[model samples]
Target: MKLPNPARRSISPFGQRGLKSFASIPGPTSLPIVGTLHKYMPIIGEYKFDRLHHNGLKKYKKYGPVIREEIVPGVNLVWLFDPNDIEVMFRCEGKYPQRRSHLALEKFRLDRPNVYNTGGLLPTNGPEWFKIRKIFQKGLSGPLAVKRFLKGTDEIILEWLERVEIIRGKQNLDYLPELSRLFLELTGHATLDLLLKSFSRDELNRHSTSSKLIKSALDTNSCILKLDNGPQLWKKFDTPLYRKLKKSQKYMENVAIDLLSLKMSLFSERSNNTQTLLEQYLSCPDLDFKDIIGMVCDFLLAGIDTATYTTGFLIYHLGKSPSIQMSLYEEAKRLLPNKDSPVTEEVLSEAFYSKAVLKELFRLRPISVGIGRVLNEDAVFSDYEVPKDTVVVSQNQVSCRLDKYVPCPNEFKPERWLKSHPLYQKNHPYLLLPFGHGPRSCIAKHLAEQNILVLLLKLIRNYKIEWNGPVLDSKSLLINMPDGPILATFHAR
Candidate 1:
């Protein structure tokens, strides 16, 4: 039973490939069109984020540090890693834009641009990005975020803790939706003050069409994510999925316009007690309505998604290892924080084991597999011609997982990050960048840290988490999730 060569045909997302070098690129050799696709099938559903850190390591080892393959017909992507390449990637802020490449990132620009646009920080590039980045540095980065965000985390997290307890006594539940709801609510209040403190205890919640437009922008683009590298059916034809994806874009565009219109009724009246985020933007007379709202939307998407998934991973790993879990709980209890003594600037700074737990979780499961950067110019890397618009994809996931950095990357070891370990600070400062690095890093880095810290402290301090079903690993979907409903048991401490 010999298989005939199918490389003579054209390859699209829905097409076939005729290139010989395709099989040699270190991907799964057996189902070529499918390639490594089946291995990822375990990831199709809700618990996706749980396994991303594991899959990243597996694929990188099976392939090479750098993998080149078609995500779709006529589209090729290179996923590369090597610390030296960091400078090649981030040194310039011009020719290389974040949203370029197969992201079909062009599709995201229906609205006017700001920080998250393909040029400023999240995904954007150019002279405009450099200037805008400066404002972020002065306004959002470093000391200010740490100073302002650390205090509010306790109140926000305590509210989420009660919501999470619904699954604590139950068995075989889909806790991710719970986590998402919690994260979304937490992000809204803590970051934007856009929603109620606790989930409205209501189902079929109302969302403005403009809000839908904001979500649609994410969903439509998200629909194209892993599809670029799979089979070739939808690419060559007007598949229903493609139609739906296109329709979503149109719906979102109309939604964006509706939300962008300046209305006296739409604006929230300023009060002295309004959250800092809303206050800052409302006072920025230079920021137009459409762009500011879009930026707020972008901020929510990035901030909420990362924190939810990362906090989910932290809990998952903690549940996986009992000894470390015990250690964390004991340390948190030793500190004994109360509402009267909430997680404050000093409390967060003083909590040594909390830092270890977070750093270890981040080391093992960086929410982003690698930090993405746009090459500002056409550059030579190891004498390779990386064109002006090329996107640099580093293997931060595998980098931190490697034996050199974390010893046993697969095995969870909070002990590796202990203060006594001499290699703790000096060995590689950016190895565990769950919040990202450099100037373009997350504006809510401190905010996320505080949020996760509060939630984890509460959970560990109250109960010990154990599994009631097959242990799940983190998977990916834009960010990350567990492979399925995480079934766990909680014993009160």
Candidate 2:
């Protein structure tokens, strides 16, 4: 159906068109007040959320790359899957690039004025976002920061491996929870300079504060996705999802405060002079106790799942392809001959094939279906003029899946990432940005890469990873993860 002409409606001083008038773009059929609510019923049948990605894929196929959808009554979104259009959309992004606002997150932060009056990097914008971002770069980025944490992070991974060995002999071991614990432990150690012990053998305390924090963060993420992608019901009332989100928020705030207090106590005692990520933040005079704690909590909430899921995807693909796993094993063996040796920044840098494998894995299965940006100015996709304030989503998954962009895109070909390969020419670097790009890219890129490389360095050296189960499908909930327990048999080398 044709949309109303945006130009005819009222305009903003910044040259924005009428918010509701998107007549130039094509989208699914919609009603007056309800918008496109009825059209999504089949996809959300009885609230089974697995169809979210599938529905998006089907819609893109039907509506072409640059399509529009009014998920809510007044909110309109323009989705783009074409690489060239994505380039155009990103080029138009102003100095302060704003991701699509998380309404649920904003509301939750506002509900608790004291703990999170200034929301963390995710929801905040303009000067505040830039300020927090600069602080994050100082604490989290740089070669020195990663080098300082390598030994400690590696020690935690080794402990996790010890935990994995206990059940390695089992026919079908559930690796999901274990991986979650692994990442939680890593993030905990990196941020707080303390082992979370979330994966310890105590059933009574199995759901530790660390575990609870990760769980709450994930639940909050799922709720936020539903609010934006599904019907806009949460906007009208305090629905069950909204309530759950609030409960999760409270849990997160409490845990963050406890962590902050612990760090403060340590600071007073001068127990250790080592500058951990939290220590660096605590030293920042501009930030208050609340903001510092919020930043640390943001590290845990944002860091755990994305790192865990990305690692899982790497294992899933490598385990499925035995030859590829062998090649990776050989590469690791060549880089650092001693299997028992600790991985260093120098060694990791030379581990070219391993890095390529990670790059390829992300290209195939990005963290989410696409990256989102709220256009700061009017932009054009194809012939359609998308006005300012419109949410533009770039379909990275679809673009990477296209054979034209990357030859044999579906197949697991890590060599494509290596410039030496003939197929490498087929690759467009922009098409596979797992960490995103530009000034607002993921600040934890270096840390995450080091974490994964260290874990894989040990993992490939010690075991022949294999997976034989029902085809493991991925569900997108902020980060894409295996839909069910990843059953794998780890044979120790």
Candidate 3:
């Protein structure tokens, strides 16, 4: 279906006639004091806070494409399931797209005025966000900068694969934990040029710094979800969850500062030939130590679980479908004929099928619940006049799964994304943004994709993956992750 032009419907003058009032938008019934908060209450309510993606689909079915809810007394949220409205949301996002998430983390940073300049990239908005983003973008904004890390990243993948073989020992293994370690190592190498040795036999002990960092990140993420979704009494005072979040943040901060100091001390000795992402930041004249430290922490926190879960899902899908796996393997063999062949820029470009498979996985199982934005101006979505500053979320997850937008919504068909294939789908550009869009999009997009692609190439070329456990599903924990252990058998070819 061709969507109506979003440019024509949005950003009308305040006195414009015939535009429906924002209050008239359809939604679940709101109560006096609680607002729509009661709708998520146990037994009495239909929605579960953790199952927000499921709730989004249900909301679209019950209340059409545009749904409204006062999540809390003062927090009004408008969810746009229509791609056209989603387009409008982006177009009107203005210069600094203010995505109001990680409020608890933002407050945590703001409380520590001496340690942090702002809440980092994820939560900081407006001019402050723009300032930090510009400097970081210089280092990792495009594919060219990301391609430099491919060789180092490939080496890490090879080492992790060796560790995987040792750990699996001819049995179905829960690969998520190992994948997490692999990504942490990759992130460390790319960000700081630091070899975390996450997969090293000697470093496998629980007391290692890598292990502590991983644990702290996971604990911090869990606390974020709890505090963000719960009643948020922490905002007023230091709740136990808030305190726990601070403790985790403190540990991560200390690690980043120590690493930064070491890197600065060794900066002059390092060659000017191939610079690490951290080196690029240090070379920047504008960014201070505080800025670089914050970026490092943000990259580490954001990188690990996201790539781990995404690659986990990709592997799970390949294991479940033999035909798809075989097809991908043929492409992988063409690009990587030998097990030790380096995944260069040319190889990455030629691995079209592998790219499609990742795209399809993202469509079926996006990491985030949805892309959100606090509108910069008043806009009309689905004929309702949504006022400025309203939190309008683009429900890409729900939209991608609908039969109206996607032909085989439930099926894992990568061909739909290929232009040369007969099953090629002409989808709206805004429909499937796994890394989001525009200026506020993921800063580490290329690096993350490179990591996943290199891993996929090496793994598929070496083994035949098979799912050895129950049907897998996802549960949201800030980001969507496999609800149970990913039990898979990797049969060496």
Could you tally the backbone clashes for each prediction? 36, 1, 0
Measured by TM-score, the strongest candidate is 3
Q: Candidate 1, residues 57-121: lDDT per residue as tens digits? A: 66677766555544333444556554444444555444324544223223344333542244224
Which should have the higher TM-score, number 1 or number 2?
A: 2
For every candidate in turn, the CA RMSD to the true structure comes to 9.1, 5.1, 1.6
Clashes of 1: 36
Displacement of residue 408 (Cα, Å) in model 1 is 1.6
Off by over 4 Å in 1: 1-76, 92-123, 128-139, 165-167, 203-224, 227-275, 337-341, 378-388, 422-426
lDDT head-to-head 1 vs 2, winner: 2
lDDT of 2 by residue, 236-304 (tens): 788898899888878877877887788789787886677667777788787778777677767877788
lDDT by residue (tens digit), candidate 3, 1-493: 6756655766676656777788889998878777777888899989887777889989988999999887766778899998888888898899989977888999988887788888999899999999999888876889888888888999988988888777766565688888889999999998888887888767778888888888878877777776865677898999998998888888889999998888888888976677667887888888878777788889888998899899888888888999998998899889887987889999999999999998999999898877889999988887788888988888888899999899989899999889999999688888899999999999999889889999999999988998888877777778888877888988887
lDDT of 2: 0.76
lDDT of each: 0.56, 0.76, 0.86
| Candidate 2 residue runs with Cα over 4 Å from true position | 1-22, 42-52, 203-206, 230-237, 271-274
Q: Is candidate 1 or candidate 3 better by lDDT?
A: 3
CA displacement after TM-score superposition, residue 54 of candidate 3 (Å): 0.7
Q: Which candidate has the highest lDDT of all?
A: 3
Model 1, residue 147: C-alpha shift (Å): 3.7
